[model samples]
Target: MAHLQPKTIVIVGGSLGGLFLGVALKQLRKNLNIRVLERNPTCLLHDQGAGIVAGQDVQEFFQRHDRTHTPLAVTSHQRLYLDRKGNVIDSEDKQQHMTSWDLLYHVLRANFDGVDSEYAKAPEPQDNEGTAVYGYGHQVGDVEIDGAKPLVIHTTTADGNTATFEADLLVGADGPSSTIRKLIDPSVQRTYAGYVAWRGTVPETAVSPAARDVFVEKFPFFHSNGVQILAYTIPGPHGAVAPGTRLLNWVWYVNYAEDSREHVDLMTDKEGTRHHVTLPPGGIQDAVWTHQKEAAQASLPPQFAELVAMTTVPFVQAVTDVISPAAVLGRDARVLLLGDALAGFRPHTAASTNQAALDAMALAEAVGRIVEGEDAAEVLGEWEARVLEYAREGQRRGVEMGQRSQFGVHPLRG
Candidate 1:
């Protein structure tokens, strides 16, 4: 009888990239054990409501990893740019689709059901012993990576239990303010863009008949000027709803002045209940909402103005910039950075999620090759090279677009 060699993998941050990687690797390794450490108590995971347009890279990856819940298409094969007055400036041939963050999360979660029979007939049982596991309410306290069998992850469980686990590999799938990254390399900077975003969704039922008619009739509507706004219908829990019942999502960017910093910080209310804070949230201050209302009345379109007024809970995020050290701490062979953790891109390109999906597939292939015993570090190094090249290119492009957007020169100048 042959004994099975054990392989343990720890992923910090149970968000998109982390979960996607865990599930993809589990499906591939079949023998490696996987665990995800997510800080937010399970209750706060679904509060975010922004929508993302998945590119070919993401679409193909989701199809391969977990096809069960790929969202039903919600975009109209068109990309329209508009002006501040809600007038069209130029249109493009970009065929894009929109899906809410939560919807995508649900689809990914469903794929991890570990019950293959549902998606396939006599589907080769996913390694019954091999599992892709999720641990909620576990906050990562600190991380220390030693040579082989490195990566000591200190965590606080949901039940308030403290424990430390070690793994061969550690990934910071954590978002903008990743604690792991901070411990690994403190010099990496997260710069602010002097802007803040107020994001929220209004159900089809909440929106007025007129607003619904306009949103459904058109896919994404944009408004330019220093105040930028983008709105679209995205997949929600009840399936794609009718115009009035569809999920209408919006992200509004407001430039920050020296005195107005508090306006952005005030996104959270007093009860430690974050209505919106880039990283911290409990409750929002009264004056912040007052300022937001005035700004909406003055800068936003009539439809958007109404939508903001309609939303019961709006999230505010103070925009910040984050870029990893040119020299990521890993051996540069098997461990690599992906998504926002690698090269943080502004929202202008709407390519963040797409980038992450691309990372998952790329990493999977690299790991597959590593399993074949062909120099794990070498394979990973090559992957990092490719990621860095493309990520830097994308970042450059995003910065250009952001600058153009600020000056009202972007194609959609709306």
Candidate 2:
């Protein structure tokens, strides 16, 4: 009898979703080879200074997988609603954990491939474990799959060199603009939600005493006609969580009709380049940000306006929604779509990261069954059906919440 050969899995996209799946698979099966390909040329991704609401699944993932045990989030003890005058009108006792994108990315990278950084230290490599590789600057050009043959992935390096890789399975976690998703199903596309979020963050020490008092340790929100702004505390630079070192992250959602002149202008950066989804920090034009600040002063609560004024480099992200018809694709179901590639949810639900964690956890649970002589197609088919339902439900809830908040229309009335 011949010994069974280990299966090779190739994951495209080194962001949170891809990293989550890679780490989970590496931990679950020591004999499975995993390779992660990222299009970004640099090893470290940009911080973006975005805050993520750590759902239950996310916290559990870290607890189960992360060995460093570094404090991952800042806890918000209450939810507060303020009027235009910054006076609290209503409050509820609720606790939530907030974390930074950079911190989470670094922690996952450490766990996936034993890469050490300022935020997390890598652990010692396990004996008898399969190989784990992370390839940066590798932009996937195309994927080819033949029946009963290994999948072929073609890529071009940053230096313009081309290479090929073979894998038993291909996973696409490359986010909303995923190249793999397009190849698999080009019919699915993202639709803009008629609004955009103007986001910024300020250091805790920089906030005024009055502003700090109202926002610190609380998830604060202010809603006006067709607009909403919210804020929470998150880890600061280099994942610092100390009182003075933390950051107060804020996002203000404003309505803009699709393709309107105002929308076009807002999406244009200072360099005269138009962006589709996000305008990163330092890209916003001076006039655009100045106008937004003036609007904030007139419409936002005094504390919210003050925080916006203190922001040095504010960014903007266009809200969008996308739901694919299927999660598993191609002959024999060898290709898989995960995370935003599977469904791009509105930010209202704050379930994007949590959804990715859930997908990773579910797949990890299914791998053992497939390895134990179960039909691969049947097992993966079941997994796909479960996650696709989850993604659709999340997308539906996000749309309803966004309509109620942004358009002031209840789903029942509609």
Candidate 3:
């Protein structure tokens, strides 16, 4: 039996996957009414701090779908490994590229707006001629899709405003702790991975001139062991900044025993405090920067030590275990899950954003098929299959990494 095509989709999360899906769906189905629900109140300030490298396929997808006329600034295109002595051990100069997260978000946002512009400029004049627009600060409290059109939804927003926007489909692109998933499948939840991640970006000036030379000489940092950190500079707000003065980003992983009581307490800076950071929402207390820095200095080799020492400011992050067992969509298949909401890859693969972009493209194609009289369920099923396959591969690798860390085996070392 042929399935009903989804005419409306509600994307819950205005981050990478949600934004890209909005633009892609609008491009594919001009009449598709799309709304993005962002938990964040404002879009003025983007918190995406660092950059990542997208492979050829991802880059090509951007070129095909994104018509924002903005060119990506490639910071570097290689991953280099160095030993504790600050000497080069191995390098994969072939597969390297640098992309700031904020830059990608800006480009995608512009492209989404371009989609609206194209709709406005459409030669045809009708309500369904172009994608209708809406962005909500929704704290999705529930998702009940058992109705005639499968009214997958949220209860209300953070400010006590009730908004029940019904769509043919509901997309769960809301990251690891997806409320949509909880509403649909409450049994599955994210568990702790028994490890924590420490991350921060420092200005190039924070490091000595010699460190600057080393960084500019290479792009992404990695190691054969499981432990690896990538660092590169991207364009900052001001253009006149020195070449290395841009943000230098890195993440370090440390394993913690189950039920380990030792942990860093979250601290608040004083009124006049110069450096301050509120840990990301939902983040658990992590190892203190001082303790983490000392651990890195002691355990890591000299080359990594140099990078850690140079990072004047650092934030601790905890790793969690989360994965959706099955991918389910509405009867009409109007909405779907993408990126971390559906599947989260460990940072080791460095494929999180790339996977999100891929999800955008794949979901667009699937929705396009449904619009052309194909079975919406089948199309979505195929999309989910491909995405889940990639996700499973990533999880397999991540699990291996977690096991190695637990057993005192260093990650990245072959």
Say which candidate scores most in lDDT.
2
Model 2, 293-320: lDDT tens digits are: 9998988888999999999989999999
Which tens-of-lDDT digit does each residue in 1-414 have in candidate 3? 156567877888888778878877877745888888888766433454555656655686678866654555545645566565556566676545555666667666655643222112222233443564546567788766664655757556767787777877778888878887777677868776766666766666666665665565356344433355556655444311246446666667666544544532432222322221234422423345556567667666554566777665565555766778766654444546778887776666667777788888888788788888988667777888998887777777876765665444453442
lDDT by residue (tens digit), candidate 1, 61-132: 777876464344476555556555655566665556677676566556666534332212112345443766
lDDT computed for candidate 3: 0.63
- Compared with the true structure, model 2 gives a TM-score of 0.96
| TM-score, per-candidate, Cα-based | 0.85, 0.96, 0.82
Which parts of model 1 are misplaced by more than 4 Å? 1-6, 70-72, 83-85, 113-125, 205-210, 217-224, 238-244, 258-265, 271-282, 326-328, 331-335, 407-414
How does model 1 score by TM-score? 0.85
Per-candidate local distance difference test: 0.65, 0.87, 0.63
Better of 1 and 3 by TM-score: 1
> Which has the higher lDDT value, candidate number 1 or candidate number 3?
1
Candidate 3: stretches off by over 4 Å: 75-77, 114-129, 132-134, 150-152, 217-228, 238-245, 264-278, 281-287, 301-303, 310-313, 330-335, 405-414
Please identify model 2 stretches exceeding 4 Å from their true place. 1-6, 409-414
Best first by lDDT, ranked:
2, 1, 3
